[model samples]
Target: MVKRTAEQRVLLDQIKQIADGLGQTLAPFCEVVVHDLLEPEQSILAIHNNLSGRAVGDPTTELGQARITDPDYPQVLANYANQFADGRQAKSTSIGIKDASGNYIAALCMNVDLTLFRSLQMAMGQFVQTATDGPKETLDPAGTDALRDRIDAFAARLATTPRALKTEERRALLGELKASGLLDVRRAMETVAAHLGVSRAAVYSYVR
Candidate 1:
């Protein structure tokens, strides 16, 4: 066990405060820790959010040891892959803090559990999943008798007969037909007027 100087102790305390704030802000899913590099055997000075079930006075992790033992270890390791003891995936960021003498004195670390995110991803995938082998039919208006079928289907969806459809409903249906290029078909207006029990002139006004 190494002895911590007064300056290092103060620095660790301040870092602990930051870790606590970050832990609360990132709540429930993230664990924040402050490691006292001066004492590798009891490196963990504080832990917040507690996702990994680790505690204060825990020994330094392998990465912490690297920072302690190596003079050239990377100062910031961001978003690196990690895992919890129970096999939950984690994303971690470790930042090594150096004292005025250029010696690594502490480390501030954050571990984010990916379980919730991964579960949500899977749920969304299942939600959007569609059956692969059902009703390979097309609503393409250009198919034989398809335009009239589409109008009838639209009225059926509204729980009414085409000839009994309200004025707004007819106008909306004509808009749908116009949008599908079905109105471009020969005698399309005549077909629509006949189906809705209206004259071609009324169909033209609806199309407008």
Candidate 2:
């Protein structure tokens, strides 16, 4: 049986509001799937898979080919460490989720959307071309789209504040992001850092 929590339902309603507030529809690719990594009871909370109207059993496969990991960004794996470090300051929007005891839960998150950032990527490309070569126009739309998605995911993971974690708390947080489902731990951490308005290097300090 698929059980939906009040939080899950609220999230769905929020997504709807997001669409209405934007004055544009969410890309069919937009979705929200919650995972309870701490459950005794490990289970997928909600898999709101709505892909461009095409049902592709796995949401990850259906979206544009965004790189799930970045070799240059190693600060990602340490993101889960922030869970115990006083999340109040954890600047990442994705880092805001908490468990029953008001502690942050370790989960594979899928709540954020990157439509707006997609626009920014395009603008940056255009800016580069006009500023560099006004006489010759050059911009790769496909590349820009791909980069935008990667940036969004990476940024989301990177944006967060530490939760003032203890030694044991740090260990547990690391365990969560490095879990099986949380692959490319570095990229994920960097994404969280980007969201938190911090440098990836600062996040890396937590892991060490």
Candidate 3:
């Protein structure tokens, strides 16, 4: 085991403080850890958020090995992808701390689980779906003029112009059109794209 100097101890304390702040700020999804390189067998000095099922006395990771064995190893590796033991996706960043003699002494690591955000995305998608054959009126005869009127009405409901509608709004409008069977008309996508000042592909993307 390596001996830690006073300066090394102070550096570890400061890094642990940062880990605590990050853990609180990104709570539930993020995990922050500080490792003591001098004691690789029991390197984890602190762990926050506790997402990975690890504890304060967990052993060092492969990253810690690089820091202990490689004098010229990089000090920081930011925004790289990682995973947990249970196979959940994560985005991680690791920072190596060294003392005045260029000896690696400690490390600060952060891992953020992305499953929550992905689940939220799926929920939003489901919420936005509208049922076909609902009571809403369909476009009469499915012509360009009728399509324009439908688009204008939907845009008005949102207090925005058709040309100013965002992607989500456009998608919602397409949903309405599909429910009304207006999207089944010949050249319907082309007509809508022309009215929205966007490409035909962009209009199709909303439905797809």
Candidate 4:
């Protein structure tokens, strides 16, 4: 193992703390690693939330190797597709760290396992699955339910029941219904009066 300079050692230690904190915060689902680029043969300095089953002192990854070869390699490679050796899919982000001279000295990487999210998506799909070819029916063919729903919503907005609406409120509602052509529906006056707990003549009076 190559000996690290004091500055390099401090930087790597700080990155290990970050990896540990991130690993705990995102626990059981994400893996966080810090690699010491100076020692490519045993690059991995730390690994947290070990999803990929890798260990400290493991060799550098292809990405780390690339950074070792080129100082100008992308500093941030985000949300790329990756997979564990066991074939679990992953979403990965890698950030290359540099020393004062701009030489890539270390790397911080995160790998998020997609297995749980994929399982959740499939379970939800099954939970909400329904027969698309079944006979379709219009339960409210005449839109009476819609009209009743509107009345109930309006009354709810006023913090009252339809049957408890004051006379003026009923008049205003009747005027709105007339303007919307709901009053032209067959037996609409009867429906409105019944919902308002009043006589059909009362509904006519309000509309007039």
Candidate 5:
């Protein structure tokens, strides 16, 4: 496993704090992971901080290979990092800080139970309702924080779309499987397909 940076340690503490304070507010059972860089081509991930456990079968995520390699790709992770650094948000609901080059500086994400949030939203009880409908948020705090602004904006775009996963995200998932010694490509595709509600073909399309 790779060691986190000095600044990243700060983010790690924040992750623990958030997990303690608002972890329940999250959907459920969904662990949040944070990374600094997405080296999809090389299957390398630079994790800054994460609350998601590395228990029996957990590996880091490296799901940005395809899009990261494409210069014209719409949702490249590097692009988001740059935009966030420039104080401009990207399209997805990514909750973290990234350098101009897409290296994660600081971030906070919660493992959420989609079903519960949906049910709670349907009930429309005391949950705070924004102009948007969902409750997922991205935060880039101070203290050695390297992530730029607009990360929240990128995360918002991610939240609005139903199937808007980026190459980095897919690559991240693949890395997780590989590191766990469970890199059965075919099985991985099937499992990811089931989780994303996409077809095995789509999973292969991104991962391959």
Candidate 6:
């Protein structure tokens, strides 16, 4: 192992401290990790929240290797999507740390589990749906088949399949649903997400 200078150690320690604080601040959903670039075989120096099922002393990631091999690699890569071994989706950001000699020494990564947030969103949407009185002849919100039919009809109007609709078309469909007050129905986003073959987060992105 190459011996790290005192200055290098101090820099790494500072970075670790920042990682620790971030882990605490974004607890339960986010995982913060610090990787030691010098030790690729056991690169993880510290980890928090433990979302990805990776522990300290785990092997380095492909991004870590890229930083070592490519001097032109960006110092920060933000808000990219990732997935865990258990199939949970995450929105991740990574920051590469460099020593005074411009060599990559450490990396700070934050991974936020979108699966949990999506579930919470669905629950909240269900809970907050406005109640109405009177006999309405709309599609049953609880029936997945009904929801799928609505999605298919909307997609048909655009001359595309629900799974192949462009982003703008998806947003338009969502807008139409909202205008029709379908979004106010319980679990509507969940059904739409399923019909579109995407996570609820993707559905929410269009709404947002």
Which number leads on TM-score?
A: 4
Model 1 over residues 119-165: C-alpha lDDT tens digits?
Answer: 99999999999889877876634443777899999999999999999
Which pairs of residues collide in model 6? none
Q: Write the per-residue lDDT of candidate 3 for residues 76-187, one digit (tens) a residue.
A: 9998989999999999999998889998899999999999989999999999999887897866445767789999999999999999999999999999999998887778
Clashing residue pairs found in predicted model 1:
none
Q: TM-score: which is higher, 1 or 3?
A: 1
Candidate 6 residue runs with Cα over 4 Å from true position:
131-208
Quantify all predictions' global Cα lDDT against the true fold.
0.90, 0.39, 0.91, 0.91, 0.42, 0.89
In model 3, what lDDT does residue 134 have?
80
Give TM-scores for every candidate, taking all chains together and pairing residue i with residue i: 0.61, 0.24, 0.60, 0.63, 0.28, 0.61
Report the C-alpha lDDT of model 4 over 1-208, residue by residue, as the tens digit: 6787788888988999999899999998999999999999998988999999889889999999999999999999999999999999999999999988899999999999999999999999999998999998865437577678878988998999999999999999988888988877767887888889999999999988
Order of the predicted models by TM-score, top scorer first: 4, 6, 1, 3, 5, 2
Evaluate model 1: give its lDDT. Answer: 0.90
lDDT for 111 in candidate 3 is 94
After best superposition, candidate 2 residue 184: deviation in angstroms?
A: 65
- Model 1, which residues run further than 4 Å from truth? 128-208
Which residue segments of model 5 deviate by more than 4 Å? Answer: 1-4, 27-57, 62-93, 99-102, 105-107, 116-208
* Model 6, span 1-208: residue lDDT tens: 8699998899889999999999999998899999998888899999999988888889899999999888668999999999999998999999999888888988999999999799999999999887688577766566556667778999998888999988999999899888877787788898899889989999999998
> Which digits, one per residue and each the tens of the lDDT, describe model 5 over residues 30-111?
4444433332222212222222333312332333332334433333232122112334322222354443555544433333
Q: lDDT, candidate 5, residue 124?
A: 88
Once model 3 is optimally superposed onto the true structure by TM-score, how far is the C-alpha of residue 188 displaced, in angstroms? 33
Superior candidate under lDDT, 2 versus 4: 4
